[model samples]
Target: MKDSAVAPTRVDGYAELRDYAVIGDGRSVALIACDGAVDWLSWPDLDSPTLFAAVLDQARGGRFDLRPKVPYTAARRYLPGTNVLETTFTTASGTVRVTDALTLSDTASLTPGRELVRRIEGLAGSVPMGWSVQPRFTYGAHAPHLTRRAGVPVATYGAEAVAICAWHAGQPQCTTDSVTARFRTEVGTRALIALPYAYQEPLVLPTHAECEARLDHTAAAWRQWSDERTYTGPWREAVLRSALALKLLVFAPSGAVAAAATCSLPEELGGERNWDYRFSWIRDSAFTLDAFLKLGCAPEATSYLWWLMHASQLTHPRLHVLYRLSGGTRAPERTLPLSGYRGSSPVRVGNAAAGQLQLDTYGELLQTAWLYTTAGHRLDADVARRLAEIADFICTTWRQLDAGIWEVRSAPEHFTQSKMMCWITLDRALDLAVRQLIPARHADRWHEERQAVADFVETRCFSERMNSYVRSAGSDDVDASLLLGLLHGYRPSDDRRMSGTVSAVEKTLRQGPYVNRYLGPDGLSGSEGAFLACSFWLAEALARCGRTEEAVSLMDQLVALGNDVGLYGEEIDPASGAFLGNLPQGLTHLALISAACAIGEAAR
Candidate 1:
């Protein structure tokens, strides 16, 4: 790393989305920029309002900063097989290493409700270090009440409190909105900082020794989890990293997997294309279950399927596009007044698409149930009956115009991919019925509707001139999501129609490894970068089509697209290589793992 100023450059006080690395303790996540600023963090739960919304509004939003006080260069990476981040800062005077982690609980010690640990070590000459913690609660809507608690600087708001603990750091100067400190480090010197948080409970003041032990134990725990994964594939490292990122998005209390770690981190910069992704989506159910099982995450798979069944029970036969991580059905869309990341205005909180009539979610949910049962997990009588009813519901639902997987805001249309997924939904349910996993009473009706869906897709959804499955009936636009239908067994990979659609996707939607989701209007202003997950789906489609070499080549390019720490955002600006959506996006990582697994299986 080349020498630079003490602080990393920012776009109007905001770090670029690509510059972030995340560390989480399975409940909540924090996005730490390369410059050692924790810019985004949601307390208590992944879907909760953020304590630090700096990524959305740098001013008024709060953050934690820890770095050398003088000019320096920094290089960072996750310690191998761990979510713990080790950032090495090299200054003219000396070198220092900082390890950042959201510590996990240990059986041997009394752990805090939540803890963020930062450990620093000096290896060369003296280097001055500075640190600060600015706490803003409720999406930066409230400035924290700063006070002292048992000699430690504490910030509290309502029922939540966070204690800042420091050792060998300068006296923390309490300000109206933050706590600031500075100190110098000598050779062989060790210093530590810990943030212990409590929600509706007493704050835990941890000793330095306890923090150190927790940090060490957290790293070990993550390493052990990584070691337990069974993905010894061609892109093992990327696959494992994707798995780790996905695991962080899984809510530990409930098995719901959040779509991304953050909310409203723009799909298009300075545009009205931002939507909150902190909720779990039925759209990703199939991929989530497939990825968890393929990576040997049996426990997560079981928990997630159970969560899915229980959460969807609220709507029963009619599934919503997304659900709250806590399994609540009400995600009332709202906006915050804060300036968005780089002036992407109207930073959003909840997703309005939950009420959309997406015909594809049924397919994804049924596909998930089918995957679970096929993987040897049993479904109870009620779940089986519910699955059969969902299949019966899809029998009629597939014929209606609805929002497709893209969840476009435009008028609903007969999206070909949605119809294909509808077919998968019934097809999977029918197979489960045959296997005696689900009630077979509606088997004949499901079969008839499945055939109707197939006929509709083949007749109206396919383009004769374009030689591909169109985005919607009577429209010539090609969608990258069509690849998903093929991967999910809408048809054999070698089927002429499926192969034609794959080639059409490459010719129309793909700009090398970067693939646009579609080239049509969505009733939204501004354009977004390439959808990263679609590209992974393309690679997997190729592998499943028996084009192993092409799949491997494409997979290599997509893997290389990730940032230095092997993390991906929701979208990428293909022209500038800038990450354009939420960082550490779970769907993108899920696609990566699924693609890697498919390519590896095809090669074998």
Candidate 2:
């Protein structure tokens, strides 16, 4: 942690949490500052209006910030399976610890009208403590009217009113309008800051005596969830943490998983590559399902596949690559004028790229459905018809130019990976039809299209000079996306072309454990930090190519990139190893879990 002089105002803004860590229930998440403030969170659910808006606009964004009244240093981590966060602050007077969590309701549905608890305990000598309760509403555009209800600070903005209060207090006032509490505490002195809805049914807030038992319950719950993981491998802890991260993104009600929690956190800080990742992307979740299934988290795979089936039945001309976490079809693109993260403008909300035709999605969809079928689930006739329809659509459209997986905007090309995915769709559809004895009207047509795509990829997509398959036909540039072709079983990993492609990726895209998605600008300006997941896929490909040692070494290097806790962002700067984009990124963690398990199996 770097030392900066504290002002009445927050010293650092947007990127401040980049140094902080994340804690969350599977339904909602919060960011905790190292100084012990619970800064950003979407209450009730991930999609709900935030109670702590300070994370987006620190000056105006409200936060539930808690810290030592005296200057201090701090560090924190999540308690294993649970989303509980324990951050310890060391002051010159003494060391104090604060544990934060939202107690999981025994009921299935969650209401915002529930309690969120923050427990602060004195660990050593006497230390003065401070708590600031600022509740801004509507993304920091409005201030809530504050009142005292049953001795708790309750702020009402609109229909939604938030209660913010200090559990233990002794010291004086800074302003009549603000809720600030400052006090000194001796060893073993404890406080509980409980924030519950003003209108909810009255419930007993946990007492200081009950805090320890509550913490124990949180830890036990997480352990039980983690014990269900069947991966008994060398990197079990890393794999389990990654699985937990993926699970954290799952929207509990519908089983749809968000691609990442945040929207418009840039891949390049000041670049235009920022896109809202809060929506569910079929392509992303397909790989997520594969990762979960590989680690024996079968329920996650099953739930998400059900969500995928519901999403695919929508009547869009081309299926959206991404949907709202609630399966909403319309994601209108818009931008915010607020000062972006590190002056990175315009902070975007809904993803416009959702409407673009990414042909690879069909392959991922078919493959994911095939996994469910292979795992002994029966497919309904309507779903089988829809699968055949997707295959037929790909057979007709695969020859046309479309946005490739990277969502390049200038002009679409005959991307090798996109074409290979078409091969996967056809191959999987035919395999399922034949193996499962389902009648297929388009089997011969799908097979014919599949062969043509393979022939084209073999002949035109390969670069003789590069000695590997290039990004697309008529281009010598290679892509990291093509590395997954072998992993998807489109071709034998030991094939001469597959081996050469792995070597080519190492030469062109490898930057430590980070990998670039592709070489050469595809009508976009500026460069990005190396993508973490593509690099892992490359490692998995290498392991399949008989390079097990190098694969394991790369996995180790990648795992080391996680911040003190087992979490990673979307990308890492090769020179500095700083996390970029969204925190606790789903794609990066899912790939890590999959690659580690795949390499572990190879070692045996």
lDDT of 1 by residue, 470-555 (tens): 99998889999999888899999989999999999999989989999999689998899999999999999999999999999999
Best by TM-score: 1
- Give the Å error, residue 408, model 1: 0.7
TM-score of each: 0.98, 0.92
- Per residue, candidate 2 scores C-alpha lDDT tens digits across 231-276 of 8886787788788778779888888888777666667867877667
Q: Show the lowest summed lDDT stretch of 10 residues, model 1.
A: 1-10
The C-alpha lDDT values of all candidates are 0.91, 0.75
RMSD each, Å:
1.7, 3.4
Residue 601 Cα positional deviation in candidate 1, in Å, after optimal superposition:
1.7
Error of 1 at 276 (Å): 0.5
Which clashing pairs does model 1 show?
Answer: none
